[model samples]
Target: MNLTVLRKDFLAGVVVFLVALPLSLGIAQACDLPAFAGLLSGVIGGVVVTLFSPSRFAVSGPAAGLVTIVTGAVATLGSYSLVLLAIAIAGLLQAAFGLLRAGRWIGLIPDSVIQGMMVAIGLQLVLQQIPVFTGAETAAAGELFSPACLSVAAGAMLILLLWQQP
Candidate 1:
């Protein structure tokens, strides 16, 4: 409510945007969708979701786990637009469930089951990126292995690992 609080919130938002931008793009790439789709989704999550959120500090955004499900949906639907329609329908269903207070049922599931699902999602996400990281794009017509791409990926990973040191 105060000016200092507002400034701190703004700074936090800037940090979130910096982190979410590349993450959104990567998720879009993993989903086989254009970069703009990711940016648009991030913007909607940050802006539209914020507008409707009951908590002032709540932040919402896309997750990497969605890549597998979305990729499969696009493949099965055979059209990006159809997949988007399906997503919209799913969102409506989710909202309806939320209105009905269905989230309380989530506690019925065991914590181990939830953790196992998250582990599976994380594993799938890593496996999906293996081809890109290895430069073995299945849809590509040219070289199977690209040293240039590999080097860039390796360099990025090295930098990330170094940055995480305490």
Candidate 2:
């Protein structure tokens, strides 16, 4: 492998680690679990995926997308142990699907649909961070278009534009 490419990948990994570390803690808190659980999950996920996953570039970390599902599962089951059991079963099912080559079916999805989903997820993340950008305690409908929020929104857009330049 080229040293330049290796260096770039290493830098990217560092960035990912920095971002994933706090996110893992936040995700665990959202699911009403101790912060250490999130750290442990991240470590295990990294080790397992790195060793077994076919895709070398696949990312394995605490996902913001699963926060609601985890919270709901914990609430419905009334115990963390039940949620752990459910996760283990789900993982086993996924392994079975992988062995069956079910993952290849995902390649059948159209690029446009996948791009649209990515855009939607990006928008959702920005919407969720509106309150933080506006220095508000909560992101209420009425507060969404306030002067502070608008200014922050404009600044964020500017930063995104600048960051996207070659």
| TM-score to true structure, per model | 0.87, 0.62
Task: Count backbone clashes in candidate 2.
Answer: 0
For candidate 1, what is the TM-score?
0.87
Question: Model 2 — which ten-residue stretch has the worst lDDT?
Answer: 137-146
- Using TM-score as the measure, the top candidate is 1
Residue 8 error, candidate 2, Å: 4.6
Full-model lDDT for every candidate: 0.88, 0.83
| Tens-place lDDT digits, model 2, residues 1-166 | 9999999999999998999899998889767888998998988998899899889788888788677678789999999889999999999999999889899899999999999977776676666566666757555665654567668778988999889855
Flag regions of model 2 displaced more than 4 Å.
Answer: 1-9, 104-166
| Candidate 1 residue-wise lDDT, 22-102, digit = tens | 999988988889999999999987887888889967878888888889999989999989999998999899999989999
